[model samples]
Target: MSRPAQYHLLSLPDGSWETVSCLASVIRCRATTPTVIVDVSAVERLTIDALAVLVRKAMRLRSAGGELLLAGPGPAIRKVIERTGTGPLLPDFYDSAAALRALGDDGRAWQRVELSEGESALFCEPAQSPYCRHRP
Candidate 1:
């Protein structure tokens, strides 16, 4: 029988910069697991620096044969990922159930196209639209 995958959920506050770093370190150190899920649903205000940290950490996890999934991120945090080109770096970005589905079922790689020079950050109005307002 196959063993169950290990998963970790990290919930960050609005301005908890250290938590992001700490979680990254944990993921780096805990390399035995095949899956790690970070739930940033409570993150209301995330800066570019924080996103960079997350991307780098996720990359490290991926390099070690582990996948980092982001689940139920708030609008602000999601916008940061969309704006800073970090979403593509992640294995999967989705709601709770969708994230679970993507845990280890490697059917296809999610669409992770790189953004153009003039098509980076995207700003969504009212925070309800599925699409982002692309900005140069």
Candidate 2:
């Protein structure tokens, strides 16, 4: 039989470009993991750019035989997900724990993604692009 899939848990701060870049690095490091559950409770609002990041990552993960999940989005964010027609692309759960349970945790200790300042890089688009406003 194949090996059991490993689950990696990460929490996003907000839907800013910074968060998107941070997520890009974090997910890159843990790309081999089968499941990535991102805690979005801290995100007050998910912007289109941020949503694009999630969708792109989710598609990449799915193609690699893995999955990405959004957990703990508020009502407004939920509406955004549904209205944007990304509900099916990105599976969301009530909370991280619920997501873990749905994936059959088996009590395994999962690794949590921590953001490092030095590794932040812009993954959205060319930083010089005038349309990308959230640059630092």
Clashes of 2: 0
Residue range 1-136, candidate 1, lDDT tens digits: 4323555555555546666766565444333354567777677777676777788767766655666787777777767777777777764455756787775475543332222323112212232222323344
Among these predictions, the greatest TM-score belongs to: 2
Q: What is the C-alpha lDDT of each candidate?
A: 0.58, 0.71
RMSD of every candidate to native, in Å, equals 15.2, 6.5
Candidate 2 root-mean-square deviation in Å: 6.5
Q: Candidate 2 clashing pairs? A: none
Give the per-residue lDDT of model 2 (tens digit) for 1-136. 4334566788898889767766765665434464689899998888888888898888867766768888898888899999999998888899998887777655555554443333223223334433334436
Instruction: Summing lDDT over every window of 10 consecutive residues in candidate 2, give the lowest-scoring window.
Output: 116-125
Worst 10 residues of 1 by lDDT: 119-128
